[model samples]
Target: MATTSESEPTTVETPGSDDQSREGEIFDLLSNQRRRYAIHYCKREDDPVTLGELAEHVAAWELDKEVAAITSAERKRVYTSLQQTHLPTLERADMIEFDDRTIELTDEAAELDVYLDVVPADSIPWGTYYLGLAAVGSVVMAGLWLEIVPTEAVPELGWATLVFALFAVSAVVHVVQNRRMRLGEMERPP
Candidate 1:
């Protein structure tokens, strides 16, 4: 039997090693709501923003208040929080390059957008939406089967075929949209 030297290291190939590492890092960086908000604000910018401006916007968003309505106290609170805590955390992750004066996003940080979802407050979750669709589809199919609805207007097999096609097409569209967002090529729809 041959024994390997203790000083020698072996390389192991883990499945999706790089992607998994990146995904974990993204989750880490975005763990905090404040950090997510910072990324959301930064991702839409055309240029580097002053820390003050960034703080103001972030504060407004956090408070769910208008920028014009933001009080001096609110501004100061957010500014201090970012300056002392959040900005340093993001800087260490290479998500953003933050100076005492101005802040800018890094290219690596752009990849973070893929992991963040921007769902509207009023909308239902996709899982719930799909469940509702399935329920309605089942009821419609049952109606067709029992002749609760007119067969002359639409046959049972024909109705089921159309419903399945609609779902298949909708699923395809949903997948394409998800891929686009996951690639960081598109922002979440408002």
Candidate 2:
């Protein structure tokens, strides 16, 4: 009996794997609204901010009011939550560096903006809205094709142009949204 040695490629973890793991961690840490608010506040600031300032912004956001309207009690409540819970969790996830007095975002924290989407209540989801637009555009096109709608004033090509314009505008908006969602990357204007 001959014993044969079989060779198999050993799997090595890529650098991207580390990034993916950190991204997952970031998503988990940012799952809480307070944590998300903390990240947004940190990104907006040019310098490291005190916990008090962060809490004020968070409290204001939570209460759906202006920062000037944030009461001391409200601020303190958010401050305590941040100090004990959110900040530490973020720090653990390597999203931010925190100490007793001040906290600052790390490079990893910059990657989190992509996951934070703020949709207004009155607005429909983008997918649904786009579908509705396409439906309307299709009906208009069909009307023009079948000569059911009056096109004597406006040329058939004009109706098609309107549909095309609508789609083009929507595409531009979607591109802008995608650019905003880019994490840790800067978009430079030519």
Candidate 3:
């Protein structure tokens, strides 16, 4: 065994520590709506965006107004917050490159695309929709098993095929919608 001095420090690398840390950082960055909007704007732009332009659009989005209609005070408030807090945080996370008032997304920002699915407040979650579909299928199967409907009208194989088709169609639509909802995938942020 090697002798160790009390003053020496040992660093151990734990499996998945980097992943866990990265996940933590991502969640923390996304916790704020302003940061989310900033990321959204960056993703939508092919070229690096000036901080002033970022602030104007963010203010417009937050205020639910056109960019020209946004008051100076509103723009200033969002600008200060992003400059002092959100942008720096994003820069440190390596999700964005910030330099000399210009902002651009890094490769890590693309990784965040999967997490940016925007589910509207009024819409049902995908999980609930799938559950309802399953329940309806089960009920129909039960009815068929009980012979409530004539087998002459629809055979067991036909019912099974119809159910399978329904699920397959719904899954395809769900995937398409999810892709549309991801950041930068659409003309507007979802």
Candidate 4:
């Protein structure tokens, strides 16, 4: 009979064991701008998109030009990169179904939206905004507790209600904005 000591480590496989690794893989796949653009394009389409069309749109976005304005050279560079590198990576990850000419998103591709929260360069992140709001609320509560003249003008219950209202409104707006920021949620990629 084989015996194991208490000091020995054992491994147990759980149904959700792969979730963390899968999330990491998803993040890695989305880290590239071209891959994200390709995924966004496929996501917006109800059917598969041709490789040429995907490459043209991606190149145009990268160049900040219209698809019609994209130079053949620019399109070709993006086409080659997607064909040789990005597409295969995404396909292997099961995020997209890619053939020689066309690409379509798989069910797994939709899962990526949960991880995509697009924040513009000039905008603050939702987490930061919430943190700031919480800080302000705390300061206000402190003032009320200390019976500061302005804060004391309102009853404690009224102040509490006001604070709750602010957070409630902020949360609702956050949810709406977050949904809009998700990949493929808007006319353009978030």
lDDT of each: 0.76, 0.77, 0.87, 0.87
Model 2 C-alpha lDDT per residue in residues 138-173, reported as the tens digit of each score: 899889778896888988888889888998998898
Clashes of each: 0, 0, 0, 0
Per-residue error at 25 for model 4, in Å?
0.9
Top-down TM-score ranking: 3, 4, 2, 1
lDDT tens readout by residue for model 4, 1-190: 5678999987777987799889889899999999999998887776899999999989988888889999999999999999999999999999888998999999989888788778878889888988998998898889877777374467888878988898999899888888877776666666
Candidate 1 matches the true fold with a TM-score of 0.67
Poorly placed runs, candidate 3 (over 4 Å): 1-14, 142-149
Worst 10 residues of 4 by lDDT: 144-153
Error of 3 at 80 (Å): 1.1
Who is ahead in TM-score, 1 or 4? Answer: 4
Model 2: which residue pairs collide? Answer: none
* After superposition, candidate 2 runs with Cα above 4 Å error: 1-24, 64-73, 144-151, 171-190
Which candidate, 2 or 3, has the higher lDDT? 3
* TM values, all candidates: 0.67, 0.69, 0.87, 0.86
Find the 10 residues in a row with the least total lDDT in model 2.
181-190
Error of 3 at 108 (Å): 0.5
